[model samples]
Target: MSDVRESEGLTLLGNQGTSYPTDYDPGVLETFQNNHLDRDYMVTFRCPEFTTLCPITGQPDFATLYINYIPHIRMVESKSLKLYLFSFRNHGDFHEDVTNVIVNDLAKLMEPKYLEVRGLFYPRGGISIYPFANWAHPDFGYAELARTRMFEQLSDLDRGDGTR
Candidate 1:
C-alpha cells in the first residue's frame, strides 16, 4: 500500500478552495503513483455531467464521458479528473474531437498499458453522436484488445445497439 506521502502532489483532492479553470486546461490533471504495478487492472471513470460547447453554433453539448484504462505506474486523482473535465464546460469542440482529445491527454498523462475514452453526446438534432478512441502501449500486448474493442464498438453501432 502507498503511504500518504505518495499523494503529496495531489492538491485538488482535499483542497476546499480550488479555483476551477475557465478554459480547456490539461494542466489541472494530477496523478499519484500506482500501488499495484505488479498486477494489471482496469480503472474506469464516468463523468455524467460533462458539458462543452459546439464550436460552430456556440451551443451547449452534453455528454457522459467514459474513461477506462489499464494503469502502468501512475493513476489520475479523481478530484483532479473531475476538475479537469469541468474545465471543458466552456470549451468548444466537436464530439469526435473532444473524445479524441481526452484520450490523447490521458494517454500522455499516464502512459498506461491501455486506455480508451468514449463520449456519448446527447442528440442535438435527432442524431446522437458517440465517439470512441483508444490506444495501447506496444510492449503491453494490448494492441489486439484495443483493436477488438474498437471493432466491437463499431459493430454495436451498426446494430443500433449503442453499446458504447
Candidate 2:
C-alpha cells in the first residue's frame, strides 16, 4: 500500500510466461499516461487470483493480493506492476515473506507516504492464512490499522481473491 499511488516513473515491470518484470510494463505505462493515475488521489489494485510454486515442495500456493496506496510524485505503471507480480509465478516462499518483499520493493522504488499489501492465501489442509503487511510514518496514526482490519475482514467474504 503506497499512500501516494500516483507517480511519473510508476510503470509496470518484467516479461510474461516467465519471471521477468519487463513484459508487464509497457501496457501499464499506456494506462498510466491515458488514465493519469500519477495525478489521482487514491488507487487500489486488486489482483484477485495469483499463483506461485513452493520452493521446496514444488507445490503451488494461492492468494489474492490487494495493493492500496496514494500517489506522491509518480505512479506505478500498470504493465510493470503486472510483470512484477508475474515475476512471482515461479518464485518460492511463504505467504508472509512474499507479502513483505513486495511491500519493501515498492517502498524503495516509489517511496509512497503510505503503503499496504494484503495477501489472502487459500486453505492448505484444513486451514487458511491471510498474510498482511503495511508501512506508515510515525506521524500518521490509526488509519492504517483500521484499513488493515477492513482488509482482514475478507475472511468474512466468500467472494474473495487468491494468488499462488
Candidate 3:
C-alpha cells in the first residue's frame, strides 16, 4: 500500500537477489525520509542472533543487539539493517567495540535525535560482557536524557541487580 515515493532511497527491502556481506559494511545501511516530523517516537530493533569474532582469538561471539532511536528526518530501512548487521558475522572485534561501532555507524547515517546500542553478549570463557553506547544531538536538548538513561542502566549493576 506504500507509494514509490515513500520508498525512495530504499533498495534492499524487496529485492530477492540481495547478497549477504562477509565483512562489516555500514555502507549497506539505507534510509528513507521520516513522515512524522511533528512527533517523537521510539524505534527499536532487536537482533537476537548477532554474531562476530573475537579480535584476539578469532573465536565466535554471540549477542543480542538492541538498537533504539528517535528519528529526526530519516529512518533506517529494516532489510538493510538486517544485512548490515549480518555483515558483522565474520568481523573481528571485542563486544564493547562492536557495540560502539554499530551505534556510531547508525548515528552517522540517520543523524537522529537520539540513538543507543546495547549488546548483551553471551558468556565466553565464563564471562559475559554487556556493552552500551549512545548519542544525542547537541542542539536537540536530549543530551541530559542520554546521560540520565545511561546512568540508570549502569546503576543497576551498582545495586547488585542483574536487570538491565
Candidate 4:
C-alpha cells in the first residue's frame, strides 16, 4: 500500500500505511483474527502490501502490524515516519526483531505513555506467526492510560489496517 513508488529522502508520501505480509500462510491470518484487541489508544494503518528484503535470503519479508499507543506531548510526524519505516525495505531481520526494533525506535522518538506493536507475519512453513510487543513510559499519566484490548470498538483506523 505504498503511496509513492520512489523515496523522497526525509520527506514521505502522505500515503496511508500498508501491510507488508499477507501470503505468509493461512495460520498467521487466523492467529490475527483470533487475537485479542487489548490496547489503549489505537491507530491502524493498512499497508496492504509492504515489503522488506531479507538481509540473509535477499527475499522480501512481510507482515500486517497493528501499532497502538497513548501519546504524551511529542508525537511522530506521519510522513516522516512513513519514510523511516519504508527505509527498511532492503533491510533484513526476523519478524520479532523488526517489530521490536520499530516499537523501540518510535518510543525513543515519541516517548508515548503506552505503546504496543503486533506483527501478523504471513504463514511460513505452515506456521502463521504474529509477534506482538509494547512499551510504557513511566514519566507522565502512565497509570490512568486506557489499557484494554477491546479492538473492534476502536474508534479510528489509519485506514483499517493496524499500524501507528
Model 3: per-residue Cα lDDT at residue 145: 86
Give the lDDT ranking, best first. Answer: 1, 3, 2, 4
lDDT of 2 at 90: 73
lDDT of 1 at 73: 90
Instruction: Please write out the lDDT profile of model 2 over residues 1-164, one tens digit for every residue.
Output: 23223443332233334335422122222223334544535568888677766778969888788887665544566666766777677778788888888888776666555777887788888777777777653444646664665565465455554321
Model 3 residue 108 lDDT score: 92
Task: State TM-scores per candidate.
Answer: 0.91, 0.65, 0.91, 0.60
Model 4 regions lying over 4 Å from their true place: 1-42, 141-164
lDDT per residue for candidate 1 within 1-164, as digits (tens), equals 23463545776766779999999999999998898988999998888899999999999999888799999998988998998899999999999999999889999998999998878889898988989999999999999999898867767677654554
Global Cα RMSD, each model: 2.4, 7.2, 2.4, 11.8
Per-candidate local distance difference test = 0.88, 0.63, 0.88, 0.56
Which stretch of 10 consecutive residues in model 2 shows the poorest summed lDDT?
22-31
Candidate 3 lDDT: 0.88
- After TM-score superposition, the amount by which residue 147's alpha carbon in candidate 4 deviates from its true location, in angstroms, is 9.2
Positional deviation of 56 in candidate 2, in angstroms? Answer: 2.6
